[model samples]
Target: CSNGGLEGANNGKITVPAGVTSFTITTPTVDDDLKEDTEAYSISVGGVDATGTILDNEEDIEVSSVTSDTQTEGTSLVHTVTLSGEAEAAKEYDFTFNNGTVEDEDIGTLQFSNGVTYDASTGKITVPAGVTSFTITTPTVDDDLKEDTEAYSISVGGVD
Candidate 1:
C-alpha cells in the first residue's frame, strides 16, 4: 500500500460507530519537489478494496526574461531566461527567433550558455538538470546601408 509516493501506516484498526455503515479513512502522503506523473494505490477494509490517486503538486516550468537591453549594431542583444523552479530532470523547451523588421542576414550566430544547447533540426533548447537560469545572445550585423532601426524577438513555445 505504500507504492506511488504514498506513505503512512499501512494497516490499522478503525472502530466504526454503532449502526454506522460508512466511515472515512485518511491517508497521509509525502511531499516532494520532483515533477512526476499521477500515482495510484489501493486500500482494503473489511474485505473491500478502494482505489486512490496521488495528484502531483509540483509546479510547471516557467520562462521569463531576466534581461532584454537594446544593443547597437555590431553588438549583441543579451536575453536571460529563468525558470520558476529548479529542474528535477533535463527538460527541453521549444523557442523561435523572429526578425521583425530586420532581414535574415542582419542576424548573426546565436549563442547559448549555462549548459544549454540549441537543436537546429528540432528548433528546441535543451536545458540540463539543476540549471535554473541561462542566457541567449544574438549578435547584429553592422552594415554600411543606412536604414531605420530594426526590431527582433525571441519567444518560448512548448516545453517538454
Candidate 2:
C-alpha cells in the first residue's frame, strides 16, 4: 500500500514500508529582552501533524540563548540602555529595563535645591548651580539627550 492509503487499513494499525527515512523540525526565531536573568519566555512552532502531535515532546518550546548588544552607562542621575537581538519575525517583543546604577565622575559640585536637566538631543547636562565637584551616577536619556552620557562645566556664579 502507498503512504497515504495506509490510514484506511482495517485493523487501524499500519506498517511502514521500507525506505521512508527522516523528518526534520524547523525551529522558529525568538526575540526577547529580559530585565532580569530569571525571566522565561515560551515559543511555539506550527506545522505539526493533523492530530497536533509533536515528536520527542517538543511542543511549546522554551527559549534559550539570549544576548545583549549594549549596556547602560552614565552618571547617577541618568542612564541609557541600548539593546539588540534575534526575535521571531513579525512578532512584537517587550524588553524591560531594571533599575541599575553606574559609576560617575564629579564634574563639579552640585548644590542643594539646584535643578539639573538632561538634554537627549545633544547629550548634554544642564545644571542650575555652581558645583565644586559633582558626580553623576544614574543619568537617564531624555528628549534633549540622545546618547548615554554628556559633558558640562559649572561656573561659580552661574545662574540657578
lDDT of each: 0.77, 0.30
lDDT for each residue of candidate 1 in 1-160, tens digit (9 for 90 to 100):
3223333444365444456666566678889887656789997777999999998798876775455669888898888888877766788888887778989888888999988898989988898888889888998999998888998777764321
Q: If scored against the real structure, what TM-score would every candidate get?
A: 0.64, 0.17
- Determine the C-alpha RMSD for candidate 1 after optimal superposition of all C-alphas: 7.1
lDDT of 2: 0.30
The residue-by-residue lDDT of candidate 2 on 62-128, one tens digit each, is 2222222232432224222211322222211222223333223322222222233444465344433
| Residue 34 miss distance in model 1 (angstroms) | 4.1
**Which residue pairs show backbone clashes in model 1?**
none
- The parts of candidate 1 lying over 4 Å away from their true place are 1-30, 34-56, 158-160
